[model samples]
Target: MGIKRLRYWLSSLTGQVIMVALFALVLIQLVGIQIYRMEREATLGLVNSRFTLQRLVSVTRLLNQSPPALHDEILRASRSETLHLRLETSQPLPDERSARFEHIVRSKLDYPEPLAIHISAEHNPRRVHRPPWMHPHHRPPHHRHPPRPDIRLQGGIELADGRWLNFTSLSDREVPGWSAKAVLSFILLAALLTGLMIWLLQRTTRPLKELAQQAERLGRGDKAEPIAETGPREIRDTLTAFNRMQNRLDRFVSDRTRMLAAISHDLRTPITTLQLRCEFLPDGEDKQKIQQGLKRMEQMLNATLQFAREDGLSEPIRNLDLPSLLQSLCDDLQDNGHDVTLCEPAAVIYRGRPSALRRALQNLLDNGVKYGGKVQVRLATTPEQVQIQIRDFGPGIPEAQQEEVFKPFTRLDSARNLEDGSIGLGLAIARTLIHQHGGTLLLGNHPQGGLLVRITLPH
Candidate 1:
């Protein structure tokens, strides 16, 4: 397939819409997972920060007491609503180390400045006066303080009243490195799978569309063969069905055509024999009548055989000058003294089964001369189509009866009276052959008081 057509199929609104919807769904799912992970991380951060604060408060209280043993009773007594204190006999760090230590603890509790709490000495706490420009609505600084930096505990929480507590440690990065890699890999794999599905779906649909086009051509009576059966199961089955239909139709037409040709062929020998025997009759008025009847019978048989030829059997197409052929036919009829005239005599080359087309045209002219008392043949052409008209001057067939007259053996009363030997197969066979040639034959009443038969052929 050409790139243009393939793109057209893929971009068809239905397929494009489906693909877009699926891709959007996958994207939303990925985004949702990421959002959930971020929210979980924030929750864990709060828990870890609160736990660190409580641990510092407990160890600082323990050092202030300078206990012989870090007794559980002393730790319990120091506990308060704002802080939990722990006493231990550990030497105080040097001033520089202690100062650096405080910086790290303050950094760990890095809230916005307004939410920060100050740690102060238990006795004679350093004066903390509000700044002169502080907002009137702000409250005084609270007594409780955050944990010192040096202490480390598994987890803890500090309260405003100097109470503290601890809890087990936990990492907020719940999704591990391997898990994140796996998830990303899955998304890429899913994208690849989705692309493959789109390609396969489009490939399957293309042949089905082609098959539908072929079936339409067949319905229009143009020769169209079955497509190659290859695709998904549904498309393959549809192609198989189309092939089967073609086979059945071909067989049916072939059988009927053969039967008709056989029956018509069998009648010819008898017709010829009858003509020969009619000649042996005594030369009287009765013999003359009988000979005329035999000749008409022979004509009907010939017409039938011509109709059968429109079936499976056909001559190979070749290029021929249409104008020359028509002129020749006109000349032969004129020599026979039928008023047959050619409107246009220029050479026109066309590809066709020449013999079949010639016979069809000749039959129309014959009917014109036989009943219309005269024949006028006119030919015209345009870029897209060709038209031939044969008009007769006899009493024309009624408009309603024109259609019936085109059926085999359907002789109109007027037609029968005009030609006493009318078998009514002439127009029928003409129509069949014209249709086989991808043309149409129509009957209309001439404005000049006669029958006008028009044949239109596509270029």
Candidate 2:
């Protein structure tokens, strides 16, 4: 049961659309995270020998040589790596001296040749003397390792020269939270748009649902009202079509009913005249046969009129005691020399059209007495529903033919009496009446070798 319900939900168009939207949202978020991480990784760079430590030493030494008054300015400028100053000595060096200087440079920077310097000591007479051990290879006591940069802003990467360079930066200083304000705003917008779409979809589809319900009701012999016209152009047109069809169907039924009623009405007068005419005939076999034929025709005309009238009855409902009604029917039959008994617990009140219900019950009782010698009627009620059963003691109708016997113009061979038999509309009319009261009439075999007709009514 649970799995069946789940399958039905999954099959619905609304559920499928929602599932697709959620999948797309999750996919977009995942892609965003991957791109963000890739951008972060691209911004971090590795160190190289050409960007040697000697360049940093030269720049720092130059900054230190500046005048005391300009010291703060130089330091501040150096922090942003904007400074670009040249270092010039007082005299030219000999070839041997330059070569020795290059070797010392290699030993100090721990790399070969190329380097870049940024500050100049032009405004100061003396450069800050570096201790003999203060070479590029000689790491400073305060610098345990190269400084890491501000990750949230622009991050800095360390060069082999011991200089740090700022890399890619984010435009915003602070990242926004996807919390109450943001979420609420998104939800409000989505809700407004979704509501509008839902309304439009329902407008287009509601008539279709109503039309389906109408078809079902009609199939069950119910005269449901036609669908109303309201919605989009397509839906409105469809509803209009359905209303036209219903109107045509109603007219057809009306015309047929009127024709049947007219034919039966016209024939009744002649049948009455013929019946009277036969009564005065000589007392012989030919007269008796003619009388029987006229009687049968009258019975058919009467049954047709009754059926036509039944279709026009307004189903005005009322509350009545079902047990008492069944007992009354059984008692009446018994008093008329029929073997009918009533089995009831107590008064069981139910809501239904009383007159129609009585007619249905009467038809069943009549059938019981006509076929079976003994009739047993029983009533039982539960909190939720009520059931009345009429059992007859005789050869029951065949199981295969039980459903067939309830159709209009149907009669069992055994029930047909040459002397006096009905036109075979009783069961059909009973079924129609029972259905109007929102109940069911079922024919089944009785356990005690007879037929049982059960009527069930819901509370």
Identify the leading candidate in terms of lDDT.
1
Candidate 1: tens digits of C-alpha lDDT, residues 281-382:
889999998888878877777777766656413466568778988998989999999888988654567766687788889888888888887888888887
Q: Could you tell me the C-alpha RMSD of candidate 1 in Å?
A: 13.9
lDDT of 2 by residue, 209-273 (tens): 88877865554345767788887788789889888987887788778888989999789888888
Worst 10 residues of 2 by lDDT: 117-126
Please provide TM-scores, in order, for all candidate models, with all chains considered together.
0.49, 0.59
| Model 2: how far residue 7 lies from native, Å | 11
Top candidate, metric TM-score: 2
User: What is the lDDT, from 0 to 100, of the residue 105 in candidate 2?
Assistant: 38
